[model samples]
Target chain A: MISAKLKERLIFIGPLIVLPGLIVAWPVLEVLWLSFRNRVQIFHIDRWVGAANYLYLFGEDLRFASAVSNTLYFTFVSVGLEFLLGLGFALYLRFSPEREWVKGMMLIPWVIPSVVSARLWQWMLHAEAGIVNYLLQSVGLTDAPIPWLSSPDLALHAAIFADVWKTTPLMVLLLYAGLLGIPENLLRAARVDRTPPFRMLFCILIPQLRPAIATAVVLRLLDAFRVFDVIYVMTGGGPANSTETLSLYAYRTYFQSLQFGYGSSVVVVQVMILAGLTAVAYRLLQGKNPAAAGDGPGEFHPRRTEVKE
Target chain B: MVPVKRKPIFRVETMARILIRSLAVLAILAGCARSGPLPDENKTVHYYQFSLPRDREAFDRLRTWFHEEHPEVNLQIHTLPTSSDDQHQFYLTHLGSRSLSRIDVFALDVIWLAEFARAGFLMPLDDLFPEREWEEFFPAPVQAATYDRHRYAAPLFVDAGVLYSRKDLLLKHGFAHPPKTWEELVKASRVILEREEDPSLNGFVWQGKQYEGLVCNLIEFLPSRNPFLTVAESPRLEVDRVRRALGFMRDLVVRFGVSPPSVFSMSEEESRQVFQNGRAVFMRNWPYAWRLAQQEGSPVKDRVWLSPLPAFAGDASGGKGALGGFLLGIHPESPAREEARAWVRFLASPRAQRVLWQDLGLTPARRTVFPDLPSRGIPLDVLRQVMESAVPRPASPLYIPISQSVQAYGSGALAGVYPIDRAIRHIESDMGRIMRVMH
Candidate 1:
């Protein structure tokens, strides 16, 4: 027989569960359905073409391939740099006795909105009148000013640098929390054992902070893979489409080109790639620990027994 | 075991209390954001428009006048994005839906007439705009507003591509006249650049970005040779003429080095900035730049010279400006057709045309409205010549995709990424595919 508590919980939770289902899942499901159907004329007519859109993305369009590679390149470079920088900052803050004030100041870049940050970076990197060029020229770096936004080779790197600047603070905050959660006794034990500083980081500290590193990297990877605003504001995916990320490509196809059939396919491919990466991340983080199997707020296990000062 | 002081209940109570208080405050703030709803009205005309930089003051004046005079009709104005690409996409999102949008009147770009009309987003204005009334606007703008034998819109204003030059700079370099052809333009620019040792100064500047501005630049160049080939006849593209014209454009910057590589990052305003500061000897831009160049504090003030965009040396059409203008149309799904039609009629009137000319410096689409104004300035004379000899872009329903293809390939050529010949071939083939789909 069902307990009275169980029946009461079901009655309370049923409507609450449906709220998220309606808000998020329903639209995602609708777009998924649209991916299967071919939009013959605007959104009025639809013809069923199962997996045809997916096949076209892989087989037919060179733009889709280029966009995929560009997105991956952006993701890999951006997340990798952010990780190293964030870890470095977090480690410094942890070891330094008088870094509380500096820690607050460092979060300012992350606090500023993304669009505002992007526009600021765009002005700073302006080829003719920007201060960056002015400084470079004053120091006798080169005789000619660099075309930061106009050149195909330089546009991607300029945009990547901007993304790295905007996101590294987030990584620092997350990794700092993980750094604090480490037990003091363990560090003392390592000190007693005379373990080298690098070994302590790679073997003990990093292994224990696996969950936070996983969260930070996966979040940044997902965000970077579909980058739009920084690239849009700075390069506009131009100079021979050098900085066109997957999100910008999908947006251009759906809105500018008015090709719903193909645009939805781009979105579907992005989702598939993100899901695969996330699953791999989850598996890697779970490493011999079944209790810490899930991601996100409620599902994630509290691995810390004590918060070190 | 030690008895623990577990304060979970008290902590939960405090959090719940704070959450409830914040929710109430947020609810009050949300209410403060919105005023009372409008009263029930029979006619509510929602005018949707892209926000042109120069037209804001005129738009506000017109909106106020229309509302104050006609109390029975609720005339509201909505501003779309300034960028044409974004504005086009915004309209498509609303108009492409299965249901009717709330927008009653649409102030359209000239290139959008074919697309919106073919898609049935626009109501034919043949009934609303009679022949006598339609003939008031210039023929080129009228022609641009027409599609499938139906007048889809009434012309609002005129914009034609023109070349702006510094008269003092040219005279200093010993040139008595403006360049009449591509070859002459290059020769004139080179001489000026050689004499002026300023690294900031350039021979010429124009928009070369991968956008609609880039398409405008390419269009001004391409048709001067054949004068007959257009994307309207894309399947039968003249590859050789296109190659020559594009080669001329690319050679201006890449080969000749008259323009900076940064031109690829510029639009109309950026190029204007380069020329208005006396850094550029000449700039290819629209008539709006004339007003800005003639501003009091401008470095090139009173030294400005305007001319028609130069053609090839042997071309029949001398300095043919590409046709560009605005059109106002009615939405077929509008519930307030009467009010919307009245708004359109008011805009096309003599009073409206005068303000558009005098206040905003937008070249009036009406022939009789600003006939005497051309005699007032040299720029006005050049403007008149360009308007008279203008050629419209291909009135295709697939203009968005067609223009995208041109921007991609054209920008490739200008950026030195793709060779001019290869770029021409790609544009022709891509445009051929678009034409087949259109047919």
Candidate 2:
């Protein structure tokens, strides 16, 4: 009794569903399986260690704990700063009358490559003859030159500063898009109701932009957690291992130490952390969905008449 | 909307299809221009060279020299960080890979050939160069290059650690000449410190950074002590003499106060700059600084003096300095292995050696290059003295770990974190574990 067109539609969608399963899901599952294997020498699955690698990481490797802590510290701090800055920029751009050239000019930092940006920052941060120290000294801010990359305490902060410089523009653009998509009538209504600026932002704008913020936060958090290139170029985790991130640790384990088995375990550890964070974010977003729905009026009826008008 | 125009649109579509087909054919033909199968005989040579920032010009010259000799071969050169340990990491990555294209020729440290040869990274050079050609080279350097009765690399250059002093400072200290013994050196440093008006000025400066230099400085003084680096007929380390050596370094920093407190962070270049700026009275550095100090516009252009590292308690054995230099090793993966060998042989020839020495201020590997040349600004007798006393670092695959342990443990004492004895004990135990694992 099925129509030919309907049957063809079902047939067309069947392959699409299976294609994603075959491409992405299947490979991710394979990585999960391989991570449990004892060794990956020559890509052979020699034995099953059954969580022993994970156990050894938490139990014996002190560097694992330090790297994990450092990664988390970077993720939260840098993402938080970038979020505030991006939100502020998005608000400013949304309210202000935009000049065409100004909009184009704001995209420069985001457009440049991360490696090139990092190298530029590195030159500025050099201890002896760098511009940063030169300016600081000229202003009489401090009597001595600060060792930005040379000191353990300052190295991580320096790396974070570089990461913020390169990535904040991305956050701003995403938030700006979310802001533009917000209905202008809702904001106008809030102002008419005598709602203050802060209250309007918290009650109307933020609830509406929850989906966008969640998406942007997850993306930026993932990037900050796995920040490798800038840190690798800046410090290489020296001055007594103060700036060691999880990715750099994994790299050293695999490349420098040549312990592929252990290195894979480190990678698995990072993957688990990222996956857990994503899951938590998903649940939080889902939990807030009900609140977002509550802000809207009853929506069972379609506004066909209003649309026609 | 316009039926008459539809005919023209259909005709244009047909013409566009024809043009697209023609363009595709042209693109394929252009790609095919260079897509023919590579010949079986052609081989690519991948050479990895590690050098300092100052040697970029010399490296370019060497590149041109290599290119002319092998016109048919493809050549790749990888410039690495100036740090030798970091360069070793680059080698580790390639050797760990199962691929042959990773690298073809590795310019190795003289001491590294032993460990690398044992690890199967280096190909035996007997097939490329005859024994007589190698015999003409210095025995000690050749010995340093050999492991397990097989020659792994040919000596490329010789770097001798020497005492660099300010000639003006020595004269100001009531001594017209540089010190030759530990006692004399310390006395001169005290005199200079007493007379120098600036509080920031240092009497002595050397590499105390947590690196191979600390171990080298410690080893030079090991032979003068009662114990030695190794036990007879055993691989186990001699702990007591090693402690004495560590103790001596600590005294140099703390008890003597001749060296700067910031010595813990000073590398070769930093210490050199400190001395070259006329800030320090004496310095310990390799011969490369001789050229830099003599270069135009140097602050200490005419004020620098060079001599052997002062002996401890006037003992020759205690003053034994470690020989450091680069060596050339053929990569097992080199496609133009025979051609690469010919070029390497040319590089080692007396003609090339002499040219490198006279023109570039580079220390040549061959003994003949030394006796025939009386290069201006470098005293010939000083060269002979360094060659006679050159000692090689300990050859072991465990050297990497040993060097790290030495750096980590002794760095505490260098930074005034722990006492010398405590640091020595830590180093001994660390070395023990490393040796056990490596063996």
Candidate 3:
């Protein structure tokens, strides 16, 4: 004999839970499992070699170190630039009274596909026949056309600049949302006090958006850390492996070299690094939220719903 | 009360039986799915290939010709990306999974034949293609598709690297013909470049990117300096010879300023676009470009001329090229192997080769198809000479990584990222590590 309640639960909710497990959980678990085995090729049954793949990459490969450094450098710089530019633009939007159209207009680059933006940037930055070079030479800023993509020193910067262009718009919208959430009463009080504009900006606006800033920074950092398409399209990680990231490294190691075990180890390392960084970001900003009244200590509690009676 | 109790029990019994039957049916379906799809009765054979204009047209004609010959068998041609590396990577993952029904025949790059065979992706075709049929095509191409005395692929069309020059430009500069030697080429290009004085124009253009093309370009430079350098087992390149050759290429850009700095970023198509746009005096490309260069509305349509890549100044027998071609291999795990074999046999026939040549301008693998090459085309004499003199890239199963290392360091040296000496040492070390780990 079956209980009606248990049967109904199994018939309906069981599928809803099991379907996601089959699709998402299975692949995630497979990757974790594959990271331990020494599967050099795709089909061959490989022996379990616990942490050898990880040890080989971290210990033996110099390229791995360079890749990690490059990834971190690229991520930090790209995110930092996006944050500064995005906040500045968002502030500009806030200061202006009628700029509803500006938000939509600025999203052109963000809306265009990453690959398209990369190709467009590449063409515009070409050594010859590029409008950028033409302008540089015409203005007497440079005697000759710059080899933007060809120069090992300049290629990474070019890629970063292109990335900043493509992603800054998204950051602007996020910060704008944060800026809009600032209570009108708070600003009115600052105005009533005749607070200096710069002082109000530094003390009020900056302190108020700490939660948004942290969230934005962490999200942007994670996105920037795994950037593969822009650099791939722009420079292909070359001139001399100047712009290869961990993701690109793992991809090549996995697909091109057929060393799946090593590649998975690289991916696992990357995931751990991102997680550690995210934790650090959360901890540093954990106590800065003045709006929360002992609700929690280590949570990113936005003050959106907080009220003063 | 007793009758009511019996009825309820019977109802429960019926429900239990129904559930048991449903579970058994579901189990049967799951097992069938696990074992993979049953072989189809209509016998559709899938041919995996890459798309180029000539290849597309050639296959279209062959598809019709093929159906006329074998009415009972069905064919499905699937196109992959044109990049050889991409196609190989696709198969590496696809065939590695051992898909049962998707692909039957694979038109693979000649270089990939060894890797595929070694990895057990391809079936041994010794019985399918007999000795007499194997003896029909050129020996070098056949040798390329064989590993461990087992023939794995049937040679399709062939390609070889050639030097394409602006004949009109060379003639205008008082050179009656194309340069016969690398030294002569440099001297002539310098004279013409100085006279032309166009900032956009470069004297020479070639594929200098960090990829397979670099190996092709570099191999042509090697034999002139060290004639014994071959892509055979235990291959060795003389250090000084490599330096001289790479230095010569670097000098064209860094020393003489005849080739552009942009050449470092250019691939085959980019260089071709430059040459065909009348911005470059010379180009190095394959036979496919010869056909493309002559297409309508091309800037250098009537002015382009072809020849073997130049040798060292005095070595008469030193001009060599990279032997390039495509071949078809049957998937070992394919269910429709017999139908696929029949398709391969038809394609290997000389009649198909003739149709391919006539329609698409593809160079045939068999020597017999050449005598009847259509007259209204770019002269085949130069292509024949180049093909005869062409050499193959290293015939190793680990060729992908080997070529990647070469491309990376070779382009680095060419782009002045490292001096030639340091670049060679780096290449040697990296290649050694890669080979040691992989093999």
Candidate 4:
């Protein structure tokens, strides 16, 4: 009963459905199933414990609570700083006379692998031999060396600083691309109308770049949420677990502790939290864009959309 | 309209072509996914172990010896990551996936013996060594390699914590011998720091980091009669002694002001670097630091000496170093069980142990090999004594979690983030919970 046209359509679309189902959906479902069991692989303890793991995480495990707070704090602070710094760099690159060289130089941090950068930062932040401490001491900034990675109060922030340094270049690249996409005529018109630079930035440039900013922020937010390598290298969630993010906690539980079921539960909750964040972000970012509402390419046309003038 | 009609036909043809090519690539990939090596004339046995750059020459020698010993076995050696944590994770992933046949023989850290054995990842090695043969290796490492009264691995090499001191500094400060007790160490360090009046020099440095090394240091700090935890019956932490040990650790930083605040972040390498640079009066580390301290370019060359770690003044038994080293074991699921056992036996032999000691500076687990090697110095005698007194960490299948609890709360206490009593209570309760769940 299959028509020739329908057969062709099915042939083209079948892999798209089958591939993700096998690769992504299957593992996710397996983990979700595991979350409901009390499965400690080493001990050969496997049984249905329905919500017991979740209950422990929510009601009892103090480490889980700290991990949640640490993840959120790390994600938001690092992403916020990255956005501001990235926007500033992007704007400078767009207007600077030495744009090509400056852009190339900015990519050094991004191009270096995160683990290497983290190790580099670890050495630089060492309380005794670190260049950062050495410089600070020489400049009479502080008498005692700051225990950047060792102190519980400062370890998470130190990790965040490393994360921002490594990833800010990515934000700059994306935002700069967005800047390049803005139509030239619109900015020319703003200049002709005698609009101030600040006003033009807020009214003309920002509104035009909303889609790009949203994309960059959401991308960085996703990356920052599941951060593992930098913190793993720098603090190892140590100095009393102050820098322990959810991903690190899950890794420690699943791999180190061999509490596979509880670890899966942590993962499931992390995914759910990430999903909720992504959805909210998508709605908030795409809500105002006419292109997102299916208004077509003409939405960006100067004549079709109202100009502030 | 004619061009648009042709577009659909063009798209269909291209899609079908792409699909065919993708299927071919995937089929080729799938063909290559078969496990284990191809069948060969010689029996293939895969060996996995971590080797540092310095140990490469020694390992090469051992490999040549192994090949000569077992020409019928095709021994493929794989270098694992140097970090113990990474190597542990690598084994967990492969073994957890039930890909057991991929690795026939592997080296395990001393602390991982019980955990790996209890998980049924290792082959029982009792048949490889007789009761008398077991006595050839150090008793501590032999004890560590056993689980549930069954031997699971063969001791390869041994390590124990020792105190490395600046010989000139101690003598200059009027101390004729190394400190025999913790009280003497503290008093000597105070005198040296005051008379030397060096702002950059620290009185003592040891691993206080929140890692397995911290547990090792803590074990050495505790009285020999009282261990941090006992797993003989139900697991229990000796709270009072642990508190006193942890209090002493914290006092070194917060009270004594002898050890740097940075000790809270140091590992073996960091502490060794400080000692080698001659910036610390005394350092708690392993025998390997001796070779490094005496290296040609080291600032402390010829001026450093080692002794057993100091004990509390009241304890007559003196200090106890935490035993550490690698052990060789066979994978139970490997089809080449005979070859795997042979490989382990060859590696643990006295000849191989001597090569390892002479070339790599690792303390051989075999007591007989010690006499065969040339005399290095007085440090060799001290290492032998320390190895005799070395105590193994608790032999429990739940050692990883137990260690984690100790590292977290213990470091918390040492870093002044948590009170010692509270940290001890937390560690005890955590261990109790771990035992209940795993049991």
TM-score between model 2 and native? 0.75
Please give the range of 10 consecutive residues that has the lowest summed lDDT in model 2 chain A.
A300-309
Q: Write the per-residue lDDT of candidate 1 for residues B162-261, one digit (tens) a residue.
A: 9887889888888887888878888898888887878888988988887887877777887452432453444355667667667777788878988888
Best candidate (score: TM-score): 4
Question: lDDT per residue, candidate 4, A1-309, as tens digits?
Answer: 999999999899989999999999999999999999878776688888788778877975667888999999999999999999999999887765546668789999999999999999999998878999999999999988899998899999999999999999999999987887777677777789989989988877777788998999999889999999999998899878889899999999898988788889999999999999988987887788745656457546432222233
Top candidate (DockQ): 1
Please compute DockQ, using alpha carbons, for every candidate against the native two-chain complex.
0.32, 0.15, 0.20, 0.30
Per-prediction TM-score:
0.86, 0.75, 0.84, 0.87
Q: Sorted on TM-score, highest at the top, how do the candidates line up?
A: 4, 1, 3, 2
Q: After TM-score superposition, what is the CA distance of residue B248 in candidate 4 from its true location, in Å?
A: 1.5
Off by over 4 Å in 1: A1-26, A40-45, A48-56, A281-309, B1-44, B52-74, B93-101, B127-133, B223-238, B374-378, B420-439
What fraction of the true interface does each of the listed models get right, in terms of native contacts kept? 0.42, 0.02, 0.36, 0.48
Model 2 DockQ class = incorrect
Per-residue lDDT of A152-214 in model 1, one digit per residue for the tens?
A: 889889999999999999999999888876766667778889999999999878876787888
Candidate 2 local Cα displacement, residue A8, angstroms: 10
- Residue pairs clashing in model 1 are none
lDDT string, candidate 4, B1-439, tens digits: 0111324546878899999999999998888886567755238888888977777777777878888878788888888988898899888777656644388889999999888898888989998978898898889999899999899999989999999889999998789999999889999999999999988899999999889999999999986646788878687888877888989988988888889988988999988888888899999998878877887898998998789989998898888899999999888888888888898898889988887777777788988677657656545678788998889998888899889988988988888876888777777766765675664
lDDT of 3 by residue, B1-439 (tens): 0111324546878899999999999999998887957446448898888886767766878889888988877788898998776887888878877644477898888878777887888898888766777776776677777887788888887887899999998999899888788888889889999999887788999877766787788878773634323445544445677677788888888888888887877778888888988999989888888877888999999898899889887786768787788888998777778899999888878998777677766678877667777745678788777776677666667666666656766777888867878778765654554444443
| Model 4: CAPRI class | acceptable
> Which lDDT value does model 4 have at A103?
78
